[model samples]
Target: MPPDSDSPLPTDAELQILRVLWSRGPSTVRDVLEALDGDQGYTTVLKHLQIMFDKGLATRDESGRAHVYAPATGEADTQRRLVEDLRDRAFGGSPETLVMRAISSEDVTEEELSKIRALLEEADGEKDDASSA
Candidate 1:
């Protein structure tokens, strides 16, 4: 399903589960648990799955003994929501501020910087194309 822009951002724990589902597709509770490798027990994972289902962040298939879970939204869509939320709340809706703050950290790798540059160039090209059209 297309992501609902109105949906609230996923909590940290919820993001963890979403990440697994995004990467691995539909999975059982056992699958998520093994992927997490955290101290959280099976019951905790089950509870989170239930909460996610209720929140519409995930869909469940219960045709068999084990219910299969999958993300209701695409990874890119969710990431966009998360970034937009943060930009509005923390950067006064300034994309430049967000990007500057993000790159200010020394932990950002050279490869990451290259990717950012490439994305910026691509966006610029798109703008130029649009302006001339």
Candidate 2:
């Protein structure tokens, strides 16, 4: 399903569950619990899923005996939303500030730097195209 852009961002715990759902696809509560290494009890995970559904962060299927749950948003969409929020709130809406801080804060590998450069090039190309139009 397309992401609900208005939906609130997931909490840390909810993000963990979403990561499992994103990786494993729609799965039962038990499947999610197992994927999380059973760190939290089954009931805990189940409750989180219920809350996620209410918050529109996840979708629940009740066709089978065990309800299957899936992420309401794709990983990339969620990541983008999160970064945008962070940029707006903490970086005064400056994406360049956010990106510069992020790159400086982490131990990014050469390959990742290459990828970032490529993305910058692509974005620059789009900007150039827009200016000529």
How accurate locally is residue 27 in candidate 2, as Cα lDDT from 0 to 100? 96
Q: Please, what are the lDDT tens digits per residue for candidate 1 over residues 2-47?
A: 3487766789999999999999999999999999996579999999
- lDDT for model 2 comes to 0.92
Q: Candidate 1, 104: how far from true, in Å?
A: 1.4
Tens-digit lDDT string for candidate 2 (1-133): 3357687899999999999999999999999999999699999999999999999899999999999999998899999999999999999999989999988856988889899999999999999999999
Clashing pairs in 1: none
Over 4 Å off, model 1: 1-3
Candidate 2 segments whose C-alpha is farther than 4 A from its true place: 1-3
In candidate 2 the C-alpha lDDT for residue 77 amounts to: 90
Native-to-model Cα distance after best TM-score fit, residue 126 in candidate 1, in Å: 0.6
| Candidate 1 structure, TM-score to reference | 0.93
Root-mean-square deviation of every model: 1.4, 1.7
Clashes of each: 0, 0
Error of 1 at 8 (Å): 1.9
